[model samples]
Target: MAEFVEVAKTSEIPAGGAKVVEVNGKKIAIFHVDGEFYAIDDTCSHEDASLAAGTVDGTEVMCPLHGARFDLKTGKNLSLPAVFPVQSYALKIENGVIYIQV
Candidate 1:
């Protein structure tokens, strides 16, 4: 069974924006792109930085610390310095509220 926790409302994050939320003591970054929502581990795999603070270009997020890029849809490390993909969480939106499966 999966447990879903409400993280934020749709209005909290605008299109092409992101926010960091803590669920079950784990930090997760939620991104809004083209009216869709995606969630992933907030920490950068290459360094100790917040992915939520990184620059988002389409579905790719560049790590602020090392310029490593990651695919928001698949959590794939799309650049150097970050060989490991960050953990991507399941997300759902219901009635304007965003839920994350932890």
Candidate 2:
């Protein structure tokens, strides 16, 4: 089983927002949507843009570099320029702290 690493607290990211965190030296994006938390690879599949800096609309985030949209729940590439989906990670919350397994 993959070990879950505590990355940040729930208050660190607002609802419908995301934060960038390093897990094992890999950049990961932690998102807070509605009342749920999700995680995914921070790098865009088509370009080197940081998804954590992208804009979030519901469960989808738009790549700031090329406007490529990706589904946070599944890391599916939902627009052009990105032919492959980014990686998605497992997440959990305990005592208001967010943990990720990449």
Candidate 3:
């Protein structure tokens, strides 16, 4: 069983914003939407673009390099140029801080 690791504080990510943190050498993207938090692999499935830098609309994130859309909650590829889905990480919040199961 993997233990959850501290990533960032809730205040570090504003609503409709995201930030990337490395865990076990893997980059994980943490998103804040509508007072909720989500975690996913930072790299876009379509390419090497960073999803944390991509634009977010609702629960979806559009890859900045190739314009591919991915679901932030499930890491599902939702549009063209991407046939694969990225990995989604389990997240927990305690005392305004974010932790991820990596």
Q: Rate the local accuracy (lDDT) of all candidates.
A: 0.94, 0.93, 0.94
The list of candidate 1 runs beyond 4 A from truth reads none
lDDT of 2 by residue, 1-102 (tens): 688899999999998788999988899999899999989999999979999999999899999999999999999999998999999988889999999885
Per-residue lDDT value at 54 in model 3: 93
User: TM-score per candidate, in order?
Assistant: 0.96, 0.95, 0.97
**What local lDDT score does residue 38 receive in model 3, on the 0 to 100 scale?**
95
Clashing residue pairs, backbone N/CA/C < 3 A, model 3: none
**Model 3: lowest-lDDT 10 consecutive positions:** 43-52
- Candidate 1: residue 8 lDDT (0-100): 99
lDDT of 3: 0.94
Cα lDDT of model 1 by residue, 1-102, tens digit:
889999999999999889999988889999999888999999998889999999999999999899999999889999999999999988999999999998
Residue 27 displacement in candidate 2 (angstroms): 0.3
- Which portions of model 3 show Cα errors greater than 4 Å? none
